[model samples]
Target: MNKRTNYKQEKRMKELEKQKKKEAKKERKLNKERMETDGGEIAGQEEMA
Candidate 1:
């Protein structure tokens, strides 16, 4: 019984870690896209000036 519980606990921890990693990756992708758009707008403004 103890061994089964330990295995389940470890599995849950691993799943949580995986979920956190996926969220972080998604956030980074969004930030990168935002940066690209913001940079392009800034460049365009500078050119107009």
Candidate 2:
């Protein structure tokens, strides 16, 4: 019973990690699009700073 609970916890952790990664990827894609539309210049300036 203890082992089974541990296994479930591990699985839950992996699922949470996957969800976090997915959200991060989505955020990055959106940021990229916004930067492109606003102008790559903004990103370039940020890099310089």
Candidate 3:
């Protein structure tokens, strides 16, 4: 019984880590897009003006 519970706990920890990594990747992509849009547009607009 102890072994089985430990196995389940380890599996859960792995799955949680995987999920956290996926979320971090998604957040990075989102931040990249935001930075690109926010940073580039100001310079582009200034150039236009």
Q: Which candidate number has the best TM-score?
A: 1
What lDDT score belongs to each candidate, Candidate 1 first?
A: 0.95, 0.89, 0.94
Those runs of model 3 whose alpha carbons end farther than 4 Å from true positions after fitting are 1-5
Please write out the lDDT profile of model 3 over residues 1-49, one tens digit for every residue: 3546588888999999999999999999999999999999999999999
Q: Which residue window of length 10 is worst by lDDT in model 2?
A: 1-10
TM-score pick, better of 1 and 3 = 1
Superposed on all Cα atoms, model 1 deviates from the true structure by an RMSD in Å of 2.8
Q: What is the lDDT of residue 1 in candidate 3?
A: 30
Give the clash total for candidate 1: 0
Question: In model 2, how large is the Cα lDDT of residue 10?
Answer: 87
Candidates ranked, most accurate by TM-score first: 1, 3, 2
State the lDDT of candidate 2 residue by residue for 1-49, as single tens digits. 3546588888999999999999999999999999787787777789999
Q: State residue 35's C-alpha deviation in candidate 1, in Å.
A: 0.6
